[model samples]
Target: MAPRRYCRARLGGQSRWFLDRGDHLLDLQSAVDGDDVPALLRHLADTDVTWAPPGGAVQVDPARVEWQVPVPRPGKVICLGLNYAAHAAEGGNAPPEYPALFLRAATSLIAHDAPLIRPRASDRLDFEAELAVVIGRRARHLDAAQALSAVAGYACFNDGTLRDYQRRTSQWTVGKNFDGTGAFGPWLVPAADLPPGATGLSIESRLNGQVMQRDNTGHMMVSVTQALVLLSEVFTLEPGDVIAMGTPAGVGYARTPPVFMKAGDRIEVEIEGLGVLANTVEDET
Candidate 1:
């Protein structure tokens, strides 16, 4: 059976869910307001969702809708920072003994194809490509062996950063939580579709059509299972909550002649099996 993929979208102010069908969207739910994660979580528990629904698949053209963040309003948008040894070294820091984690506000996220807003406060917008893990159900205190079961799926993410604000304080929250800077989702591929923890997958990022970062998920210092286990020990990971696996080396701020994104720049993050997430930068008016 083919793997399942989903896209949460908005059309004319109504939220809807769609299963990805070849070249079209198979409408999976009636139009509703607010998030669409609860329904999916229920369906996920019952079956694999590998077959098309009975009503001949109510399909729509891809262009008819606007994409929304995979988990539109995550209860927690926890992120792993400096989770790659090489990425840590690039910033003149040694590998961490524990995962460097941070929280990102939902306001910071933009959907695939949406314009990534470069705030007026800074022209130092930077991109960090990453893999996002979506929690499947409520989980707490899970050990490493049980961690993979807590994951619902995976998506591509661009952890857009503002360099100056990031350095102004010891905490990275301010810079990382700027509205509309984070880019997430084109689609979410079910965990059953890929290797466990999505390991060994090739992940890459591009700026204005030029490859800027490239690496494999296997190289992460803290693997997906480890991150989940570690996180669940402290707090519960509920359905639709997201965890952004840290980016690999080659970020703009670390380059020889620091490169940053400006208005009209395009950025894309792609991961094997998961779809590509692309966005164009626009200045805050």
Candidate 2:
């Protein structure tokens, strides 16, 4: 088989990167003309290259550009709920006997630097900084040991929620899938470099330089591998699919006075090794 080549658009303006199937770096402009993505990925799988080209025609200053999600389209965006113990306690509950799960439809997908729009339908939008796993291969009924092997990489994710509706109903779907609600990326650091096997880790959320939610992944009721295996038992996860491990304690809705998002507010979600996801809230016109 040829090496698998994964094309990635970098955060800097006009700069792009590609990771071949073997995870080796490839030339940035090799994809400038926009090659057939899937086909390139297939070819990259069998070959190995260690270094990328030194320069390109377009130069970009990092400070002036906006970031975008790593993948433009994904087959599925799987989300976990109450997976963190402290978060469950904050919500006035015990760790679920099983991992609580949910799905955020594709429409909710947005990039890292994009504005998080205040959903017109709800005003209680909230932020959840989480460790997200991106699947690299088709998986189903995999044992816990095999779960991590199926992961493509890791990235930061903000599981934005519409609080009023989330609390108003038992099903969390409606409140979770509003436009610009799921902000993930700027990059997909391959699984090899990221801590694997669902071990302990930390995740945090901040607003205007103030830390709001800070918790460790070690407290997750179900480890990342466990969540992957459990979800795989039911649904087939494909490459590029994402899973938001879960948020920690201290969500705005769980606060004493409840601190919800308002227009003109800036939020950032950071995870141990994944990187940071930042967005500014803006009124939905």
Candidate 3:
């Protein structure tokens, strides 16, 4: 049997684990408690018994479930800025020796298919397609050689940005932290089932079915292993922590005539082997 993907969904007003079994969804929480990465992997490895849904019926249609960000409240949401050389050149920046890191608040995140709220304070709502890495084990001061081992899985992410605010100052905190700007998830693919470090995968973004940005994961200035190694040097990475690898060239603000998302536009970030993360834009009410 193929390895199962996992997602968090809101059903009956409670958050629970939903297993992606290809043709149908299974209530994973019915089979195990605590959907943390390590625990989930252990449960799968220790048992050969087929997991059945509660009462032997599919609890909810995946399309109908209210998707929640895979890691609803990650301890740390680290983002890499201008980590792609082509993106850097477009932005008129030179490649840096170290990753340009920034932190995002939990409140900035929205789930797959959820609306990305464009704040009235800014009209430059830009889309950045990125590959998100979810850490499973505690890691500190690790080298690149051991970095991949610390990861649990990978997911699709949209690093929605308020460009005007981002350039208001050298610090990008305010612009990147606007509520409901980060769209993550849909589901998480376990690392064991994917190519190591998810390298060479095609990553792209589309606005209302029109391709806006596209690149391969192999182009990142800092690979997953290197990013993990550098990050752990600063602080201990705990389970559920997320690292959003930087976007590639072709982001809205870098184009000759910039393209920004507005109300009613559907934006999608797709990564090969990971899956597509889709969200619609909504004006802040």
Candidate order by TM-score, decreasing, is 1, 3, 2
User: Candidate 2's residue-wise lDDT over 80-172, tens digit each?
Assistant: 999888889989988889877888887788877789888888889898988877777777899976778877667788999998877777888
In candidate 1, stretches whose alpha carbon ends up further than 4 angstroms from where it belongs are: 30-34, 45-47
Candidate 1 per-residue lDDT, tens place, 1-285, comes to: 555778889866777778888799987654322365876765654444554555555778999999988787788999999988889999998988988888999989899999999999999999999999999999999998889898888899999999899889988989899999999998888887888899999999999899999999999989999999899999989998999999999999999899899988999998988878999999999
- Please name the candidate that would achieve the greatest lDDT relative to the true structure: 1
Quote model 1's TM-score. Answer: 0.95
lDDT of each: 0.87, 0.73, 0.85
Better of 1 and 3 by lDDT: 1
Regions more than 4 Å wrong, model 3? 1-3, 34-38, 41-59
Best by TM-score: 1
RMSD of 2: 5.1
**Which runs of model 2 end up more than 4 angstroms from their true locations?**
1-15, 18-27, 31-59, 64-66
TM-score of each: 0.95, 0.84, 0.92
lDDT of 1 at 208: 88
Sliding window of 10 residues with minimal summed lDDT for model 3:
41-50
Each candidate's clash count = 0, 10, 0
